[model samples]
Target: MFNKWINEPKYFNKEKETIIIESDAKTDFFVAPASDYLAHNAPIYAFDVQGDFTLECKVRPDFKAYYDAGAMMFYVDEKAWIKFAFESTDIGHPAVVSVVTDGASDDANGEKVDSPSIWMKLSKKDKVIGLYFSHDALEWRMVRLFQFDVKNLDKASVGLEAQSPAGLGCKVAFSDIKYTDKAVEDMRKGI
Candidate 1:
């Protein structure tokens, strides 16, 4: 999955330096911030694992500003999608965890932490989708869960994304991105 998206750098390129998936142990894409909104318009593709699925990755922002955003995204099309990201407020403000769905933005709902290495986990069951974040890998706190209509869920491709609209560059790394089906017994528990 990484190879397919990694090879198509043109589709994910921003106004700054183009991103490339390196051959070493570090699996990340480096992008310079866009002065215009052209970078924000590109959609990150992912294969849909809609039922009881979990997607998680680590992100580090390269700058300190309001729109220095980075996170894993599930895009249903160019216009319909959700992204849970962390954005800093200049250099002195606390970094916020935010969610954008259908082009509307929401405030952060998790606890406060410093320059924290964060992980976002998004799970879907039926029409409801749940978002969670973890400071440590073991425990997860719910951020927000809302309902959305993703037109074509089964054909979607999942991947990570980062954009700095403040004309500064940020690098985001994604690893351990896996999609799996819920166990039959686990599904039966709901009934």
Candidate 2:
């Protein structure tokens, strides 16, 4: 596996098999609509991936503020990317959040998770991308299923991200990292 960072974090380390990233204050990767707001400073460690693949990891975020997250990212440049995150939400809950960016971001908050750490899965097959979360890493629950198309998509970047949009800083730990070249047969089932 190749290690590449889009935006280098303040601190990062590999503890045994786990990757830890410390996000800086007010760092994010969002492009808001109708405003002069664009944040692409959050740290992302990624590698080039082609064809179809599934990447899954167990993430534990030191969530102290709203929107602090540990994320699985599928990136095709700064304007076209997708982030599926286990995020601390504004409503005082930890939730599954997704932001699909095609020039501008379309953010959605999904199921609330009552855990400190959760398993996140991202799978890509053709033009379809699947997002799922799990408690035990066996039975995954669907978070989002959508179609995304971009130029040179087969050579896109697939990896991990750490963001702290509204806080001083956040530290996220990602473990049990697994990647398979084979994509899931069923997007809804995430099999």
Candidate 3:
């Protein structure tokens, strides 16, 4: 049900039950407001889903360079999208980072995680979307909650994304992927 969008990855394999994507060198999806530079070359394996839903996955990135991330993406178009990522931050650690892109992207870094992997959840209820991350996939902490106002926000593609913005490349493994055609009742608790 998933297909590649934009740039093709160096390696993509889904036969092992765990999805693995090796992002190519300098692959990313960002529109910087400071320099007004747009980069939308990252590979995304996504499928269109209608109505409100919850998408969850465990992302483990081979964090080799700064800004390298394995993300759960909510995509609308090149100019509008959300990247809820497990990223190797510039602060010398892996952290939860969310980027809400509407023409220009706004980046926010959340909780710092010491683990090799983390579980990410993206829930959509009408025009509002919530992002959450968990250490053990049971207790989740909110990363972002905002309205993604667009023409067809309810009918968008949700998927897995990998980017290596600064390094040559990195492999990202996505496992325990789950999807439900319902919204989370509580946005604050993310359960």
Candidate 4:
């Protein structure tokens, strides 16, 4: 089961066959060493994650502004965490982005896709974590493969997130949710 959101969203449910998240305002989670603005205010729909497990969801954002995104997040603390987002890029395209923060957030962007909707997945095997995105749920493309070192990492928060960092807000719908107590065998394999 998941805990209540960090900053509760407009709507949330853990018992549904499918899940949905609708968020408002400029909510985001980031530790920006450059600006001295550690913005960890995004509405996080999270749960305890232990050992080897995979967390995934499908997100469809009414992306109307640059930098707006819906993400799959893993939080160890404000200073150390990760977020994989399906965001509206500055070039006016939807792209996949991965942000890993040890001290300051290292933001990386993947290819710009042609859809407003995408599926994001996170696999945790020990300290290694893989992030992937898919146009459809059947085939997945790797975004980033990395590792993190966190003390008492087990049961650390992992879940769905949404942000409107450069706009008023956006409606992000997340569905087809699954939290499995197993590793995604091949991180590069299709779902």
Q: Number of clashing residue pairs in every model?
A: 7, 0, 0, 0
Better of 2 and 4 by TM-score: 2
Give per-residue CA lDDT, model 2, range 142-168, as digits (tens): 888989987778779998999999998
Please report, as a residue range, the 10-residue window in candidate 4 with the lowest summed lDDT. 11-20
**How far in Å is the alpha carbon of 48 misplaced in model 1?**
4.9
Q: Which candidate has the top score in TM-score? A: 2
TM-score per model over all chains: 0.65, 0.97, 0.96, 0.91
**Model 1 agreement with the true structure over 25-121: per-residue lDDT tens digits:** 2112222222322233422434544455656655555544445556676666554556676655554544545454453433443455476457666
Error of 1 at 18 (Å): 18
TM-score of candidate 3 against the unseen true structure: 0.96
- How far does residue 21 in candidate 3 sit from its true spot (Å)? 0.6
lDDT for 59 in candidate 3 is: 94
lDDT top scorer = 2
RMSD of each: 7.9, 1.0, 1.2, 2.0
**Full-model lDDT, candidate 2:** 0.92
Per-residue lDDT over 121-173 for candidate 3, one digit per residue giving the tens place of the 0 to 100 score: 99998888999999899999999899989766756798898999899988999
Clashes of 2: 0
lDDT, candidate 1, equals 0.50
